[model samples]
Target chain A: MLSQENRLSFFLSFASLLGVLLIWQFSTLPQASRSPYGIPDGNAEYQRLMGRSAVASTVRSDFPTPGAFARNAIEVLHAPFHNNGPNDRGIGWQLGASLLRVMIGYGLATLVAVPLGFVFGLQPVIQKALNPFVQILRPISPLAWMPIALYTIRDAELCAIFVIFICSLWPILLNTAFGVASIRREWLNVIRTLEVRWPQRLFFVLLPAAAPTILTGMRIGLGVAWLAIVAAEMLVGSSGIGYFVWNQWNNLSLSNVILAVLLIGLAGMALDAALAFVQRSVRYAE
Target chain B: MTLFPFSRRPYAFRAAPCDHGPALACQCGSTYPGIFTTGHENGLPTGAMSAQASVPAISRRHFLGAATGSAALAGLAGLFAPHAAMADTAPSGVVEKPDLNIGFVPISCSAPLIMATAKGFFQSEGLNVQLRKTAGWALIRDKLLDGSLDASHLLSPMPLALSLGLGGNAAQPIRVATMQNINGQAITLALKHWHKRDPRDWKGMTFAIPFQFSMHNLLLRNYLALHGLDPDKDVSLRVTAPPDMVANLKAGNIDGFLGPEPFNQRAVYEEAGFLHVLSADLWDGHPCCAFGTTASFAEKYPNTYRALQRAMIRAAYFMQEPSNRLEAAHIMAQAAYLNQPEIVIEQSLTGHYADGLGVVRDNPRRSGFSPYPYPSMAVWILSQFSRWGYLKENIPLQETAQRIFMIDEVRKQAAALALPAPEDGQNNWPVLTVMGQRFDAFHPPSYSKG
Candidate 1:
């Protein structure tokens, strides 16, 4: 059912993934024999305790192999909703908490950005006045704002949400403004001649014309939001995927950290894809 | 649907007492009413009270109702029963604030606080505690000052530093309720330096400490100075988070670190570093961490403060027993507390551990749990503050120590728990020997004279 081009691309993607996994598996394969470096002489107990003895092969490389990663991943994914207590929840719960925080922060950013972006697009003078401030604030890293946010907000949960809101705000605002300002003059003239009222002209005319561009901006905002939430959650350590990564790091379980990194990537990709689908749906023939 | 077939059971079912083991199952069915009946009684041991109070139970009617998609509702009722029962029985006006938020860093130093929560010491005392696991010491300090935390696990010198307004902190009066732990830190070095055991040979190496105000910094500086190497000029010391210390060592960013265990033991477990020296070797029976609260918090909630102090003291007494240490380690290693491997925590707590240099050392004094807040310990910490140039102004050291450390209050609480209190005179203010140098508590040497 697939075309030759599609089949070729799929095959290439699969082959590349296989190649990477194969390389990972080979590189992390334990050495057949390890040199007993610094193993004190005549202390068989010491050598055994240090995993240098021939009988006990407890010493492992710091990096997890593909097989180890797969085993850890299966263990983690097996019970994704088990809630042990406040500090230890399942991976599914962590991801859900992070996603919920992102959605709330992203929603608030959208609520603020779109209306202000409309005003900026409608008035060139207003846009020129605010442009410097927006440009200055946009380049500030989300982490830079964390301490200040924590200090001012005085609540860890709100501070994390505030960080996400700050990071995601600029992209959507700029994109919506740009999209609104770039709407064709001919359509505006047509609507003007028809004597459309302000509300209809704004919603029916302006909204549809700028829908794709606004969504493009929202797509970028969502991407930035997802990125910011992980860093935020890492700083505010109660519950989330970022906290899971940090807690596992505290335990020195590198495989669990790697698993979290993969989950974060997959979740981010899914978010972007969902927004892209919306963007496609709102596109016009013109 | 196949991904999570267990999802059909309410999420609370996972936390059901039955899921824990057979030991908890017997308590689940029989002991619910006994807790409520005994809730009004005073002077009962906290361990017994909590053992009875901790079992969340489903009533017979609720259990039958839970089968009809009401499991979560029933679970909520079961969870609220203990608090409701405690509130109803709490002699009306005694505990002003029954609900409390206590913050702690996820380290072995916070073992007593973690154990108190895990073993339901707070619940037995008619207090509902939410123990917030904070990220770092700075966040802990900030949260404490901002009133977000009722009390917290602090470094032994943190309350003093905050009280004196040292290290960019506002001069706020924070009181040390009880000393958390003693002699639980170590200087761990990367494996590359295993051969270079002597400190004099190491000139250009960088070391990491948990905080500038921490005892780790003072002891490390003292150790380096004893070796005739200036800590400031000969070596670079970086401030890093405790959790990141092992990763930083493994990445070769730091040559060594004088940090709190289980990080020191964790580094050895990961095979990234070897223990160069335990802090116990530097200063035997040194105070490391404290349990404290703001003076205002204690003033407003006096009864609650007393209850909290008693619970912590009892927990510390429980931890003092060598036989109880392994079980305590297992309890603290759960994901809600330290979130570490049981063996790593066991090695740190039980003091029987491999020293990463092909030696299995058994030293019971590795980490001690003493709840006493000695005034002399604060005096010694202030002396170090002066020694390290952290105290620019010459404040009254003995007066400040007396004011900050609630020695009498801790002694009273320990007495109430029927634990042995330190005797008068030499026992309370004994001379401390540090790295073969005598430090008299009565007459402190002037570090300002160099």
Candidate 2:
């Protein structure tokens, strides 16, 4: 959709990353200049390549060399396609489990949060009555819910979903309530004067009017749901990204752990980006 | 075809000593399957075998008639039940109650848990035993307290530590029903660190231990203090859970760690380190893991407690046999906690463990469990806890020791089969030297004396 020159600028941005990598590569070369780190200075690809090789002098005297790093990188890139490689879990499986939990929990939270938020949104007295309890629970870290969830629910998977539920419900509820309450009184008055039924008024007028704010709340809620799954998995002790990271860490496989972390970050970015795209395309009412 | 299918049968009361239940039955219905039934002669009580030896010579005709009737019934019962019947004629004071979810760390010390399940000891006593593999000793402690687990394979000092309220605010008081296993855990120090300095120069070094307040930590501190190193001020001690210690060492995040077995082997394979020290050398050989239950569990389920103890003794006897290591290793490997290659399992079983100090040359024996319950092990651990500031100044040591070690329960279980009262006795074998000093464990003392 953009001009070629503009696209070229976007592609060229990667050059900076390449440049930093090159500098890193050169600095880590087996022999560059004699720095106090004690790794031999040589141009061989198999030589000291991480620049800081002081610790490598022990067990793995020559690991993380340029060749080793390259091997590790290639191994990481192909990790998704293989079974039980150093970074064995493919992106698809990792992202699917996380996305599945977020969607189900977020959907359930929405079903409850939206209607209650609307009732409170319209009635000032009701909102005031419920505000304190919601406020008390809102700031509690989602991790705090893990023990209660595990002890209460017999199943680990369900407990994880429950944690996601606790984390995401509040934002959507508060936002939807705020969005419904803030709707211009004139819009409701117009619907009333036209003799529209209450359900019809809600369906056709108020919802569309408050859609942007509601979506904003959903966006925030979805993010929280994604965040909560990691913590939930850690507590539940089953198959999930959080457990995967923990298992790898227990095995002392730092590379796999780092790789999982990277995958989590990328998946989170993709999710946020997708939500942003949806928000933009659905922005027609405003 | 379904790999696992189900069949229904009428109510079956297990009526013989050999009836182990369907779960342990071979899928093919073959009587003795691979790694399933070892048929070790440990199920019978130790002294009962000797007492039965004194049975006067009876008439051949009378003996033949008694044996014939029982064998015919055993054959018919074997066809339907396909296992031994529960021993309904259990001696009095044998635990009257027994249904348990027994938590265990998947180590060789847990042989009793496996043997009890295999030998029909629990079933014979009307006990339903569920073995749960836990993350570490700390979780075992927590689960026992919260009733998630009825009992657990616990570190020796756990009962004492719990009673003293050493762990954070939520500490629950506990007592040891029996000493489960001993001397199985070894101290593993990283090879690189070992090469750099002797263990006596332990000052300013960081070591990994399973828990901050565990018995191993206390032992390590005392071992260091004897050599003029203050564990608190001179060394940087990091708490690494057992499962992570091997990897932590391989990755060089930690210099050395003290843990049970196989982890030491993994470190050796990685060429990342060696075990330069061991717990055996520290305290002449000390109490390690024990079976612990909440004081309430002991009170409410005294019958169950006796049954658990009886079963554990059966398991311990199986481990005492030298030939059972191969089978024990296989079982440990299958358990989710120690799921890995058979070699790691084998290495841990043989007690051919090497650590920062040197290779422990002792052949595998039942290192952890006590034949006779020892109260002194408690006093030894308590002194260390006090020394390390985990406990305040010593509070009535002997009374506390009495409360923690459930000798009466062990004695009741032991006497059922007419076995001798389990006394606090040591295998007065050879003495071990650390840093050219020989020490006798007859009276476990602080490191200065050892």
Candidate 3:
């Protein structure tokens, strides 16, 4: 069912990825040969049981090879939804918790941003006046909000939500502002002559025409939201993909971080794909 | 779940001549009714009685009298056993809250808390404890204050600082149920500092401490002050994480750091730095970390709190056993706990370590376990707080120490009231030897003032 051009592009993309993996494996060969911490003391029990050299093994840098990745992927995917108390849980549950937070945070951001964006776009005076505060806050990293949030909110879970809201707010707000502000003057004049009420004109004319730009902003916000959520969760040791990555870092297991990284990438792609679908439905060819 | 979920009644306490029979009796430390497991009446020897000083000397005769009352109690317990068994925390009045979360940082100082979880000490005490590994001291403080964590392993100085409202928001006073570990911290210097080993020569050098309100900072400042160098003027002290200390040292961002083990040993293990001196050398048995909770939490759930105390104190005893050190360290090194390489952890735990100066050191008391939360130690810590300008106001040192650290009799022997003891548990007041100068709890302010 695939088109010729599409199949050719897919083949080329696969070839490029294969080329990268091959290069990565070769570069990490020297790392795998020696222990990352310069010690061969991994399986201390092997010395006690069998008196073998393998007993005092070292952990390699664990730059994941294609084979290692496949093995780890299988192990991680084998039981994706096992819940073990608070500290430890299945990857499925962790992913779910993170996604749920993002959705809530992003949804909350949208509720605030879209309405405010309309106001900013509708009113030039308010937009110019409030521009400085948004400009300053937009460049600030989400993690910078950690201490302040932890202090004021006084809960790790809420702090995470607050962080996500802060990080994802900017893009949606700006895009919606642009979308609402740049609505065709003719469209408004038509609504005006027809004596259409403010609410109807805003909803029917403004929203539909600006839907594409708003969706584009939301897509960018989604990417930034996922990125910020992980970092925030890492700082706060609450349940999230970020917590998983931080916990792995505590164990000095870069391999586990890679696993989390791959999962985050997949989850991110799925989210983007979902938003893109919505974007397309609202999008017009005009 | 059994008809009676044998929890409120700990394994150390029995209901009726022990279900296994008196022949298989254990020296159950205290006398709770229906738990006739002690082989002899005076089973606790003098050495044991010293520890059991906190445990009331409930006579076997009075205990048996209490036991008869327990049979009646058991009949009542059987009536509600099924309902109780379904609940995580006993709906029964004994343990107000059962399922609890205890937090700890990933460090050797958290060995007891970690062991208590791994060894099922928490469960045996009839408590379902979730041992959450927190990220940092400040996070632990926030979590504890916010009541998200029922209890946490805290840096010894943290509760003191928090109670005094020094570093941040206070009014939510924290209490030390018991000291978790002692003397497990050390000063680690970069290999570059190998030549200028003496403290006097280290002028203008930057050093890191785990936290501003940590014993690591206190001890580092004390050491510098003792050597005639002002900690503020002569050297710089930056707050850094334990794991990050080694990386910072390796990066040459810091010349040295005083932090908890096995990070000190980890630095040596990774060849990033050399162990300059163990904290044990400066103060032979200084309190490091404590198992702590909010004062309100301890007051609210007395039984649950008692069970926690029993587990943590027993685990403290278990940690001090020389034979248990290596095995315990290995357990701690697992990904779930300390998460360091086992061998590196073994070096600090077993007291046989490569000091990173091409010499091996063996000192069994490198990390002593001081389970007792002596008020005197807190007095000394208060003096240091004043010396360092953390304590802005002149609060009564003894009063605050007793209020936070001394653990007054109101809640001390929650389960062992059948036995009798003094109100405050600091009878043989600790005579601490800090840097060849004595710190007698009576006047630690003067000792620190110099």
Candidate 4:
């Protein structure tokens, strides 16, 4: 299916990747030394065997070892059923828990934000009145919400969920309001002339016209939700990927910590990709 | 089951060594000769277990004679004998369950776990126990619900919290089958915060705690209130995870923290903070940790539950041994979950006690040592829950307290082990003082009301 130029470019990229890997492998081999242009780095292999190395290497065996880190990453990508020991708190379980929390929190936020956004968008006076309060809370870092959420709410899991909701809600609400308010004057006039019912206008004309903006808002909100979940999990200290990473670090198990981090990044990518796909599906109508 | 608490002995039941042909081997790669039989026992089942059961049959004289050739025979025997006998003399109705998975936190407070496993106390009870170190209390609760762990070393208020349906958890009837430990927790004040106030003045300073719902926080609030300081109006109280407390204090982020063991010791060693008050200071000799299980688990496995308690009691006795402290610390260091420096663990595991107010006292002080399961402690926790707003008014305190602690079951287990029984049936035990004036008894009702 590919053109000649495209096929050649793909091969070139593959060859470049192979070349880079070989250079990296050889540079890290036992006898390799730093060039005179830069200072000669000490023997990492010696330090690894001596166990009297820096705390970072001693704490995490996989540290400063690209190959080991890569292997760990590959292993984590197929976790849960793939793990073969009593201590394997898998990457997949953590990813699932994080996603579930994000969805529940983001869903709740949308339930409240969409309706409130319409009200604020339709009535300028109401929006103006609420703007100050919204501005005050919206820009506040979501992690700051944890203390009040826990003490007042007295539940860590709920607190984490609430924080995710707080962080993700603002962008969606603001964008939805902007989308609703910016609907063309001609469209409203057409509805008014035709005597279109308010509900009908909202369901048909307004939504379809504002769909692009709302989709964009959702994309932004989902990204924020993903960010908030990781930070919240780290703070909340229950069973989550964030806790798993922190727990590994405390035990000085660096390979697992690095593995968890890769999982978090991959999970974030998948979440954003899904949101992007949905946004694209809605774009043509707008 | 018996009522009395057992002596602090590695093995509760003692019997004369059985006279067998040769000493039996163990599956743990050690030759424990003259302990149990190597082959079929009195027409019992065949296999290494029979070998294990009969190894104890060897006489004292034979045990000495076999030590020379024991290692070679033990390797061959280890191939056959699958288990080591737990008790010197097995009691009737004692071997209830053969296998169990118990939960413990990977803190210095979990000395009983390392001690029990190392000394083979659980093996004596004919049980194969797995000690799982859970992440935190909440996860432990969930694991209990899902049957991941049969029992757990839990915070004192956890059972009461579950029963009251607090924190939006469905009401799961919880029972305290036994008390695992008592009186090793301290409230550490960050050095910067301590410098900001007079040593005598504990008013108007923010303190960090592990959780808002924890007993340490409640006790802190009560202690402040008892001194005429309003906890809400006087100072802000923040929550920090126990491990993070030391770093946060060193960075001058928090004023003080309340936690159990080594973390407190670590803070002092780092010069990040100093002990402000022992939790026991507020309520003299309070219970901090207990073996908690859902009532469903208790109901389903009554005999298994008793056996678990017997194993825990034997483990507790092993931990108190003066000679075993170093080994216990080493075990903790090597454990996958704990894996901290032995010095840090030893500092916390050392049984020496000191009041935050600079008063020193001996652990297991003859004046007040209540390690046995008691109903009064449950009642005390209930009163505290009501004292705070966690439980609504008009709950039947006595009935709920009785339900939470299976005093009769614990007594039965204790009596079977030949341990000391509760002298007074849940009487008003007096509060003893290490930091201040001493007393023999306390009025639980008035103490809460005040």
* Model number with the top lDDT: 1
Q: On residues A135-234, what C-alpha lDDT tens digit does candidate 1 reach at each position?
A: 9999999899988987888888888899889999999999889988999999989999999999999999899898898998999999999888888888
Per-residue lDDT, model 4, residue B103, is: 77
Q: How should the candidates be ordered by lDDT, best one leading?
A: 1, 3, 4, 2
TM-score head-to-head 1 vs 2, winner: 1
Over 4 Å off, model 3 = A1-82, A123-133, A196-203, B1-93, B358-360, B407-428, B445-450
For residue B436, what is the lDDT in candidate 1?
55
Docking class of 4: incorrect
What's the ranking of the predictions by TM-score, best on top?
A: 1, 3, 2, 4
Candidate 4: segments with Cα more than 4 A from true spot: A1-240, A248-263, A266-286, B1-102, B113-135, B142-149, B164-171, B194-200, B279-285, B351-371, B389-400, B418-442, B445-450
Compared with the true structure, what per-residue lDDT tens digits does model 3 show for residues B281-367?
A: 566567899988988998998778766776776576567656788899789877667777888788788666776655555666577
For each of the candidates, what fraction of the native contacts does it recover? 0.47, 0.03, 0.28, 0.04
> What DockQ does each listed candidate score?
0.29, 0.10, 0.20, 0.08
Task: Please give the clash total of every predicted structure, in order.
Answer: 0, 34, 12, 32
> For model 3, how does the per-residue alpha-carbon lDDT over A1-286 read when each residue is reduced to its tens digit?
9999999999999999999889978866533234223333334442322112452443333366666777877887788887656676767888999999999999999999999999999899999999899999999988889999998898999999999899899999999999999998898889989999988987898999999999999999999999998998888856889888877776655667888998999999999999999999999876
Residue range B147-228, candidate 1, lDDT tens digits: 8899999999999999999987669999998888877898898878877777887799999999998989988888888777
1 against 4, candidate with superior lDDT: 1
Best by TM-score: 1
| Per-residue alpha-carbon lDDT of candidate 4 for residues A197-227, written as tens digits (9 for 90 to 100) | 9899999988877777887888888889888
Interface RMSDs of the predictions, in order, are 2.7, 10.9, 6.6, 14.0
